[model samples]
Target: LSLHPVSVLVLKVNEVSLGIEVRGEDLAVALQAEELSLQQLGTVGLWQFLHGQCSDISFQESSALKTDHIRPAVGLRFEAGPGAAVHSPLATQNGFLHFLLRGCDLELFTSVLNGLGPFLEDEEIPVVVPMKIELLHSRITLKDDIPPIYPTSPGPVPITLAMEHVVLKRSDDGVFHIGAPAQDRPSAEVPKSEKRQSAKEQMFLVPTEEAFGQLVKELPTLQKELRETKQALADANQEKDRLLQEIRKYNPLFE
Candidate 1:
């Protein structure tokens, strides 16, 4: 039996983004439900992302969010350097598994175990499970399969909280109202339906997040990239200026 635990953020109703950490319990159920819905996604890559099936969901990157704006607040964020955690996707259900890994591929972990069934003839698929679930097959099947309506972002990495298991936390701005029944609201990346908002602005961001520490780590990377780009632009401009001066030297302004 092949199964892998994928850390994914609920980015939209159908579509979602993944990162390093995830609401493992929430995501376990959500993604199982998501994969079951799009058994077909195994074949087409990126197609589902654009259809409003998903969205990009990420963390606030700053400080404590107002308690009111927070959804599924787990209490804290994970630290860096879990890169080795991500492994080859589980081979169960064929290529269908990788689709669910899209956004949270880094946090995903795969395992092999004997598959048990009612008939006692189940195949060992090297099953995957979030660090929480011990009996992978006991979990519901079809509930995980839901057709995505878009695409999503990678999720945050797992953090071992004071309680051992990583706890969910929020960095929301505390202004927007995130609706109820958690599952009812779509993931952040679901594309806007054409019947809605001229179909351009509705489906927006893919769900993903991180805490202050993450941005702190990324800040240096962002700055370095920006500096390199700025220098490249300056060199290009200097070359253009030299060429223009040469052209002016040979051309008549009034003629």
Candidate 2:
């Protein structure tokens, strides 16, 4: 299948880090077309805002990797059997990370992005077809019903290559997994044995190329919606804090 280009969102939720991405030419084109439809229909102002300016569109992808620093092991112990007891030092890094994609073939995915030079030109919004990447983690232990290592701040950081494949494998809750070819794996005519064997060889993938293309087109809209929702939650929390402070001043019972 032909992988489309689109923005990807990577989330590191506890020990289950995951990268859920989208890839599909037809899908991407279809999303853009649908958004265009919404624009034409004037159902929502937002659709009109994104319509035709190439603002609501996306591209197909090759392969891209976002990384985190090498997490040092916390503690170690010796055991008599093949396995050894150990306690890992918690992994730490800046809390927020963001990445952008340009529409290009798989061949140029890495080199072009890596060599992306100084802010010379305008932030080049690309003409990708449609694609996505959702990366997640679930290593953190449960403490008080939440990830033991939740962050309160945000910043940009790189994902380490050594654990990159591991991140992909751990994406779906560290389930039984497989590796498959990107392009060839997406096709329906391809035999199942071939798909399974290729999966044995591939690092990770969801959906065939055709399916991926259709799926990919919606990533940006979904991501935008997610971000806005998160921001709203943060705002609500801030408001709650303000009200609590006011209560502490006026309410004599607690005092």
lDDT score for residue 14 of model 1? 28
Q: Assess the local accuracy of residue 255 in candidate 1 as a C-alpha lDDT between 0 and 100.
A: 30
Whole-model lDDT per candidate: 0.29, 0.29
Residue-wise lDDT of candidate 2 within 1-255, one digit each (tens)? 123222221211122222333333111111000000001111123333345323332332222222221121111111111110111111011111111111111221222232344323567753221111222221211112112353863422323322112211111122333343234355875445334332221123224575556557877887899899999999999999888888888885653
lDDT of 2: 0.29
Best by TM-score: 1
For model 1, the superposed segments whose C-alpha errors exceed 4 Å read 1-215, 253-255
lDDT of 1 by residue, 1-255 (tens): 013222232222222223333333221112221221111122122444445454433432111221112221111122212221221122111111111111111111111111122335556754332121111111121222223344563343433212112212111221222223222356564323212221111111122244445557777987999899999999999999888888878884723
Could you tell me how far off, in angstroms, the CA of residue 58 lies in candidate 1 after the best superposition?
38
